[model samples]
Target: MFATAARNFVEEVDHGGWLIPVSSLNDTVNLLSVVVKRKRFWIWQRPKYLPTDFHLNDILTGDTPIQPVSIETDFIKYDGTYGENMKGSVNANVFDHSSFNVEGKDSSKLQSSFGSLKKEELDVQKLLRDSKNRLLDMSHGLVQQTMEKHRQVFGIVKERIVTTQPCSVIEEVQQGGNCGGRLSFCGGKSPKVSLKENGSLRKDSDVTMEIPIHTTIAYALIELEIKHDGRFELCLLSDTKGGFEVDGPASNQLLGASRAPMSPSESSHLKEELEQLGEHFQVLSALPATTRASLLQHITKVMENKEAVSSLQQVLEQMCQGKRPVLEEVTATESHKKSIQAVLDLLEQCGQTESAQANQSTAVLAALHLITSAIDEMTHECYAVFWMCCSFTGLQTLKKLVHCVSENGELPLSSSGLATPTEDVYEKTEHLFASCQVSLKRDGDTVKTEIHQQPGHRPLVLCIAIKGLASLDQSD
Candidate 1:
């Protein structure tokens, strides 16, 4: 009974220690079968569990026979009856008659010298340092060459026209002059040589004409291409008082008084606009990946327009009535929400201001304000929605769902595999039609999931279901 208990304990420990994958267990068994070859043998005398007097004396004499070590001895007895010649093998270290050292010992002096050697004693450090320096030099040269090549490939931009305002213009007309009063003495001297004008010319009336002239301003426009780094080589395109008329205020003279220093308020507004544009560019450049994206979308619907608000109210009204809002129906209606249509119409109206006839400065400013307001409103609404979604589903669950979706793609529905490739979505969508309807409702911080059975009214209603007669409530 003691031996049986010991064996059971040993088996339990061994079983706990050895772990194998289920698929590979059969492979391990097959290998063991070939190695051991099924056989039966009688049990030999059991070895002493503790060291005995013989073991102590054997250590003193160092000439006692050692017990053989076998893999089979670990758990079960092995009989070599199937083999013709059966010889027991013992671990070489088990015997004490032979020399213990596998290889001869090294000289003490050599070992001591090896231990004393410093980093300077080896050439490896120097070789590594030299190699690194060479690598750095090569890298520097390559970078320089690359920069030079780029400089040569892309030519400088030159300006073709120069505009300037001229100072002034003069217009004159000529007519024959009539001899008037000369000095008294000159009149006497000229009396002998003076010629009289013809009668036709004497009686002719004087003709005069006025001509229009233009004056050029003092400002001159100098156009040049510049680098993004703010380091620029000025290439003279043209010098003029007035810059390109096509560029509006932006193309005015750089040195002239056209671009006067802006007021502090103007500067602040411009900076804010630039910063907002940069932020928008960054957001758009990055991929949209967030667990709250759906919630954000819902919030956007709530905050978008008065129409969206009305729609949400209608949903709430219907839900109050005897109606179960079918998630599918809600999702379909969300796709066609009049609030979304309002946003689309707003965008269309904004686009109309871009027509050639609508190129006034006021129109441009209005368009800009409209776009900025829309974006700001949308972002705030979306964020509100995200929090609402978080309130409905605990933050932790939402985070886990996000990570799972990111790593595992879609959730594993009853029949779905670990991951369904998007390419196969159209084919597999039919199989995934059983999602929880409760997960798709739109309510403030809560989604009502209690099943409702009502036969007369519409089959499903949103949170606030408003039916035929009740729709009149909207008019009120």
Candidate 2:
């Protein structure tokens, strides 16, 4: 009955769901004690038939609690790129309490017990061999799936290249006009045929195609550039009326037209008109101030009066009643040049004094404006003289003007920063003649500058030749 009771108690306590009985003994009856454990493998064993203090310190003192060290078990699989081990490693210590019986304290030898547990030491050699075979099979399947994904993307890129080349070929045929009225293959299609593959095309012939007559790579780049920056759009020519007509989802139309050259007859007529204008300007410049003002007023009045004969000649005739009816030829002599210089000097001297005074006096602003305008007129006459001299001598007279106006005040163009005598004016007009080609018309000794000229117009020898002439005239 005692054996039965002890066995039943041990069995009930050792039920793994809730408890565990680590160790036990039952022979004495004078002093009795029972110990039981709970789940998580915690042990609580006691000596039966003994006093409480007889073995109290042995069961409870000195390292009574032990914590298990951790271990990892990984069921890793391998791929073709690199193989990994299906690894399981133990790094733990065992808990024991045997020293409580003899030394009156709890003690453990977990490290040595864990090291000595070698049931699978021989079995690991066979495990290594088995892992390699399993990894190889996994690697082959992984590699096959990766290669299939690459093939699918490559197919898409190839299709785009094939579809795009034909658009260029169509443009080439239209521009060259060498298709012999037969459409050459644009990505393998007849040039005369246009097609829209968009879902909008309900019927086969409903496709729209237009060839670019003057195709340029710049036009293609413009279309591609906006795609990266913002929302991209296109419009069909048949749908939209004007500027935005050609922009659409997949429409191609060339954007710019080539410039047409002016014909010989049109060129001759323009030259004649320019020459007449030049003559009128020279007459106006040479006229006395009051006489010029009167002529302008008369012309304005005639227009206001709505006169039937309001031509410039008729207007001039009405203004010059008692004065010399026609202009008399005055040869451009040394005396003429000196007289012109003297008048220009008087005008500039007054102008510089007024310009200096303008900053100080708000009341003198209108007078300053009038003086500045006269200075501009004198400057224009100086340019006319310089250009006329060049025409007569066949020498480039503008070199001195360019040199004086240059930042360095030197003949040779240089990158070095240098100061000029007239720095303010020089900075503004230094590059004026570097781009323009001028042509002069010589009628007797008077040379007139014309805008329209023959193809033989000299390549930009120099444009404005008398830049520093105003400053010189002022000094004189």
Candidate 3:
């Protein structure tokens, strides 16, 4: 019989989809078959109770022990016959989760030299810094695109397009794919047909089919909720997120100014529209290439034509919605831990406006300032997230070194691997921990050791990497 082994079945939250794809599901089943060969015990479905961001690919490497999450992913022992090997496989860590201690784990290490090394608190802080920059860039990009769309909408100003005030009701594309209530006539015009010499329709008169009928919309509104302290959230008003409410007076005004009244729908001959269409056309020869778009928050509200953006009232009824997705957390690496205080500080600082503007109900100007100054005061305090306790390699090294020194009492300098390849490396970071020579001197109670860099005969990255790893690791 084969082992009842299966990689964790993580929930698919990286994308917004109704369900996981068939291809991905099939691949998972195939992979399970390959891993669990004969299958001693049975697992109903893949285990889905793991961490949201727990990626199995991050761990798998040759000869790495298959330690299961004791009660969670642990397979039941068929009998004591499978023996100690199978029993050891089910145990999670060198330090088990239930108890804070491990059987043969030691807790003593010299006080770590925490001078400048502590300031370089791992890659996560760097990742967070990059995220902050990306968000600000998105805001700037969205603003530019919205302004361009605003310019095009303004082009038809002279045609008396403001026929009615906007209803402010949420709507979508209608049955005929017409974007209801949208004022920009910039995309997909009415379909045209080609005619032949005898004034008859051409056989392939669908030449104008490619002309898009969908209205090209832009991101017009953003709701940035700046909560008490530094709890802040920013949402773009888009069709996918169902848009934000336009209830606040100032925010509501911003929404209304960005729209204009739509012409009432009528059933009339094509020639009937030709006369007024020409008049409207003459007015729009150039708003596309002129002035900078000012705040569109004061579009004239006309009441005479009182037919607000049609009676479409469309709603996407996704009553049985998919499960809510989770945000990926910035987890700590083995070398360093995150300071909760730093995250709180970011929430308080980056999540809020600087000063007086924070008190104002509609302080868009102040919120803009927060984006720049959010990561200003970064605390350089971090601890071991994977808890700097005894690891398998550490324990093995301690035992081996003790045994070596017990006889010789000292070794000048030698390769640490004991005439072998690096079998004890963390599979995820095997490449990062390059070759090194370690010298141990047994003086008093402690065996003083120094790890010296050894550039073996290999390609320098396919040349340079220890430098990169030093940059990556928070520990000096």
Candidate 4:
């Protein structure tokens, strides 16, 4: 029974753990009968219940040889638990003690070096920020100074042209010899005028004046002559020869001869007319000599009388209206048309050259204004000089002038491709001719007459033209 119980206990323990019974099996079986059962019976039952290779002989006894469990002791305890017990002290010293001390010193040196490197990086950042701030401040100051200088220069230029009150010759004559019978002067200096009284009539009274060219005001001269019959002539002369002589007339009979005696009002009117004419010539002096000569010749042909002036004005007015002018009367003669065409071609070439060189629309507009003002002045003087002479050449010249202005305005002057001032000029010119209706017709004798319906309207074309010219004049 004892052997059987021992074998069962060993088998149960090998499979899992030994299980104890709650009730005693001593009353169910006889102990002697159990003992009689063979050990071979348990061996056979064990193979069926557990593994086939399991056996009683494989079971370990208390005297069987065993290997001990391994415990690593090559590390130090960092919790200050070393030497608290004999086992901990013995294990703590297992590692090299001097190697840890050397590692600690190296770690301290690395920490110190890292702290210094961070401080240097911070200092470099601060220097970069300061340099950036200083550079911005310098740029701002430079820009402000440049703007201030430009403002001062602009103010000085604006103040250069003095707009004096219009002077009257009658007023000057009344004021005595000191007045010199001179009108308003444009630049810093006035022209030198010498008058000689030949008789009671202003006719045969030789009046000689020296006008400096506006462009080269220091050297060039326009020797002016006033005839006995109130006719005025211009000769472009230079001081390069030391004495003023005939450089040739600006235009053929620039002002027509007047036969009648001048009344007080008429004298004042004539003086005013001549003064305005002088200003226009002054502006023209800025252009090339050839251009000036050609324009002057064309002007002389056109300014014969009121009919011619009216005809010319009508054609120009039509041009300003953005419509083609009817040139039947002016172009009736091929010679007249060819002459006028030549003048137009010359003016167009001049405009093109100027436009090509000009980088700004403002510059082109200023040139246009100057040219128009000169034309206006010439037209006015012509109208005042001869109210009787009738000529179609004047009308042709007017057409050419309008064509020149339009051509110059159409140039691609600005980078933006839009000219604001040129548009304004066109608008004003259109408005000037809106109410005036003009017609040209030949009478039974083939004498052409310019029929004008409205006479009181004043044109603003000249005013706008002068605005840009005046600026250019100041700059020059």
Candidate 5:
């Protein structure tokens, strides 16, 4: 191809296709372009070694130097006719004869540099592996923290559920022998039993159960919330924690102050009566004054309104089917009488007035009696919250209170004749309550839970909020 191009260039010099002036025979002639046969193209007589795809021999891409070599070129021309042809050969330099062996000719210095590059690549891989291992350790710590929080929360929930369950099984077994009516909420139907001459049941018997429930403190608060557009404000606390390990070392250090022993003045009330009840008193005392005051105010408001309470008390008397037997009246000052009366009023407000009316009232009645008895006792004696809850109010005591209320109504006289205030005897009574050791704050759609873990106190805070799309849907 090179020979043909050079021959054509010589033939076209007359037409001024490529012209150059040479002063001597040694002067160089350069051809920038040439025509070979019917095609025209630019050509370079020099050898070139451009970078290749590096896939060759698995070597990296680099500047490769190629050396040109000499080759024999043949030229043909017609002298006068086609039968007489003349041919000549000459030595020419071309790209066809060139050497490309970069690896073999490289200096020792270049080879050493390549070795250093390979060492750097290995070092980079080691760094990545170590970083991955460190990340794995951190991930395990995070997973443990998340799991511990869930376990603590669930432990609290499980405990509350168990403590709140009623001892209805024993009551059911005892009532089995007697034909007396028993209420079971587990099913839709009530068990049929032969009654022994009980009083007539009113057409509004269901409403009898309804009134007691409606008049309760819980029910009253729910109503006030709906009517006044109030918020769901509730707080439950425990000074005694359940058995569960906390999260981490840093968390422990941060929470060290919370684990300090309670102050003498703070826990002084518990010293008087160190039982389960003291737990409540501790929590009650820890609560903010505003919260405690608001709670007391609501309670007092419920007790003062006796209309609903009176109606439910009558329901209990009817359910009992006649005045119960009276027992020896316990002596009391007018002030003491009034205090007990207020306590009774509070009980009635909590639907305890009808505890004797139904058997299914276990959950309600058990909690009601526990609180009522604790309140009355705490006024005169110091009992631990634990013992207060564990020991039930004597069955005889319930009958005695019921009988007195039934015979002459509230503030009934003793068998010897005692004068008691009937109405307008309410006085301000400041009781104690406490707070939990958890912090909660709202941030748009999320509630961040933070707990300062205290010794013997496992604090749990629950925040329920409808946010974002949920709020929009609820609006409708």
Candidate 6:
């Protein structure tokens, strides 16, 4: 019985040992401060179970585990008053710190590698900054050069002078017809009369005393004579009691002194008118040799009037009448004639008003100036003188001139309808002349230009001359 009991007890003990509770055993082990060492095969197979700081050599050597040492750094403060306290304090514990645990040679290599990377980065930044600065400077210089070139180009354009050729040749015949037609003529016949000794008239001698008829026929004849003679001389007066007569001594004196020197005012006025005329019409300078002589005579007679207004009106009238037909023929448009007529009507209106303002006179002059310019343009003449003259008057005057020219469709233009100088046409013909000569002479404010067309195979040799004067002084 004892043997059987002992056997049961042994069997139960063996079973209890195999069936021990895992939770109770784990708790007992934890409470007893026991070290549960994992098997070497298990540690090698399960890398996750190995300590983070464990090395293969430590495991191979089976060395005792090293305890981590906590390093503390001591910082000492030094006051300026104590020389000995000024010395810096370094902790020996810093050498054993984990951050400083790298091998001495490897630490130096790492520091050098990091320093090289930083230096390269700084050099790259400096190079990039320098390149950017250089690019900016180059751009600034280019911009300045471009601006200077544009300024020079603009200045050259502003100073450039544009010239154009005449639109058409205005024949002297046209000028003469137009000028002569403006004058009135009378159809009165001079009756033959004989004076009786007894102051009694016989039937054959019967005649009535009548006032001499005012006739433009004589004026036309005189103009024709002057044109032919190339010298201004008074027309022979008829001895008949009633005959065509001219203005007395004053008119005769002006005609007689036609070739004589002119006063400064007269010369200046004539120069200005000639310049204005010449600038517009190349033909004005190309007129027959006698034309200038005739013009000088006519101008002298017109200037005999003391009133500047009347004299100016007379000059305008002569130009309008003389150039109207030629302009109309050239343009094939009546706008030119209408424009001149409008100006004439305005001038007449101004004349009627005793209190006409200076501006009214200026306006009339502007219109006349514009009409003359249009006429010159239609004739293929330079019109810049008109613009120059009108510019001094007023902007409104220039606008008026443009308006009139535009209305007439006579504004100088190229075949493409672009505004161009008239000189373009003349330039083409310049090669046709053998010895075309252009000469300019300046005296004080007056400039005289002469163009001589040398005798060639052509039927006619042309010589044109013009005199221009500066604007009258405002003080004058």
Residue-pair clash count for candidate 1: 22
TM-score for each of the candidates: 0.13, 0.14, 0.14, 0.20, 0.16, 0.18
Q: Write the per-residue lDDT of candidate 4 for residues 1-476, one digit (tens) a residue.
A: 11122222222222222221111112121100100010111111111111112111122223332221222221211110000000000112112211111100000000000000000011223322332311111123322342232111000000001112221111001100111122222335756443322211121111122211111000011222322222222222321111111225633332211113221122233234334434443444456656555654553444322223334444444444355655666522333344445544554565577434443323332343334333333332222321111121222222322222222322222432323333444333333223222122323322121213322112223322332223232322
Candidate 2 C-alpha lDDT tens digits along 6-31: 22223332321211111112211111
Ranking by lDDT: 4, 1, 6, 2, 5, 3
Q: lDDT winner between 3 and 5, please give it.
A: 5
List clash counts for every candidate, in order.
22, 11, 7, 3, 18, 13
- Better by TM-score, candidate 6 or 5: 6
- The C-alpha local distance difference test score for the whole of candidate 1 amounts to 0.23
Q: What ranges in model 1 sit over 4 Å off?
A: 1-337, 342-476
lDDT of each: 0.23, 0.22, 0.19, 0.26, 0.21, 0.23
Candidate 6, residues 274-347, lDDT tens digits: the string is 34444333322232334323433332222221121222333464444443323333221132244434444544
Task: For candidate 5, write residues 275-339 as lDDT tens digits.
Answer: 33333333333333443344343322222212222222322223343443121231322322344
- Candidate 2 residue runs with Cα over 4 Å from true position: 1-277, 291-421, 434-476
Q: TM-score of model 3 relative to the true fold?
A: 0.14
lDDT value, residue 412 of candidate 5 = 30
Worst 10 residues of 1 by lDDT: 106-115
User: For residue 58, what is the lDDT in candidate 2?
Assistant: 24
Which ten residues in a row are the worst by lDDT in model 6?
Answer: 105-114
Instruction: Give the lDDT of residue 229 in candidate 5.
Output: 15
How far is 412's C-alpha from truth in model 2 (Å)? 15
